[model samples]
Target: MAENINSIKQKFIIRNKLGLHARPAAMFVKLANTFQSEVWVEFEDDEVNGKSIMGLMMLAAPSGSIIYVSAKGEDAEKALLALGNLVEGGFEEN
Candidate 1:
């Protein structure tokens, strides 16, 4: 039998006024790099490596856009939870 892998996926709405701009994208990439799981983010028809700043910027998601975040690896669940919180929390904006 093939070994089972942890794959977690969740959708989040961009809450920040600026959406996932440079600062937020950098923050997201930084967080993703700290995880052992492979992360991917999707917006509309565009999906990119969650750990790549350029890839994230390419999404060009605006505020109120829905995004799908997925992670496949041992820490997939934790990754999704943290990423979801980040999205929901408006990237910690006041």
Candidate 2:
């Protein structure tokens, strides 16, 4: 499935006052679930499942914190770009 293989890494800064807390994390998870790719988030040395709300919350991504996002699979490029947009846009400014 090499033709379907795709992946990308990007960093985004949290601009929302609440950071990437429960609501935003839930939104992210929901959006990510709509895709058919493996998505993940990384911060410093920690990495977590992008579709796991609990796992995302554990990151404690505070406002202005830079986070890394990546995706791989059939729709990895779209997924990663969408997620990066979400984070960069601060979850649509909540």
Candidate 3:
């Protein structure tokens, strides 16, 4: 199977009290790196590589902030779903 630019995208809200901090950003990067696709996260006019910890942290998405996760490649769909779940689950940082 050839690797095509099959993109997938999802939007998530930061409802966690702490919002997107280092720990959660780390988790997000870790998860983003798991897929054989290119992943990105966007907030406002900024977009960063989802697999990059520093890049993710630069977003500074606080509580009630809206973010968009997108991926493109062979596993784009899976990557998108996984990221969506992670964000929806608040990165499990209760």
Candidate 4:
């Protein structure tokens, strides 16, 4: 009786000058929280909750670093698209 939900994962590079620092991390978390899906960010060997500001900051990813984003839930695809756009857009810091 339950609907099917799939998880989506995608890779993105940190294009922002400051990378995923406090500000950008905060923005990521804020946008992530808006979705009903569960979000995660992976950098190197570290994976953290995408909705957690502290967790995102702990990745310590710098500009040009590679990160993988995963989302699972009803809105997984949408979440990935928006997050991908944000990162690809350099967090709009420029």
lDDT over C-alpha atoms for residue 32 of model 2: 97
Judged by whole-model lDDT over C-alpha atoms, candidate 3 comes out at: 0.89
For this target, which candidate reaches the highest TM-score against the unseen true structure? 4
lDDT by residue (tens digit), candidate 2, 1-94: 3374777788889888899899999989999999999889998789999999999999999999999988888888889888888888889775
The candidate maximizing lDDT is: 4
Clashing pairs in 4: none
lDDT of 4 by residue, 1-94 (tens): 9789979999999999988999999899999999999999999999999999999999999999999999999999999999999999999996
TM-score to true structure, per model: 0.96, 0.91, 0.92, 0.96
Cα TM-score of candidate 1: 0.96
lDDT for each residue of candidate 3 in 4-94, tens digit (9 for 90 to 100): 4798788899877888889999999898889999999999999999999999888999988999998999889999998888888878875
* Steric clashes per prediction: 0, 0, 0, 0
Better of 2 and 3 by TM-score: 3
Better of 3 and 4 by TM-score: 4
| Model 4 lDDT on a 0 to 1 scale | 0.96
Distance from true position, residue 41, model 3, in Å? 0.5
Residue 48 of model 2: what lDDT? 99
Model 1 agreement with the true structure over 13-58: per-residue lDDT tens digits: 9999989899899989999998999999999999999999999999
Q: Tell me how many residue pairs clash in candidate 3.
A: 0
Question: Candidate 2 deviates by what RMSD?
Answer: 1.6
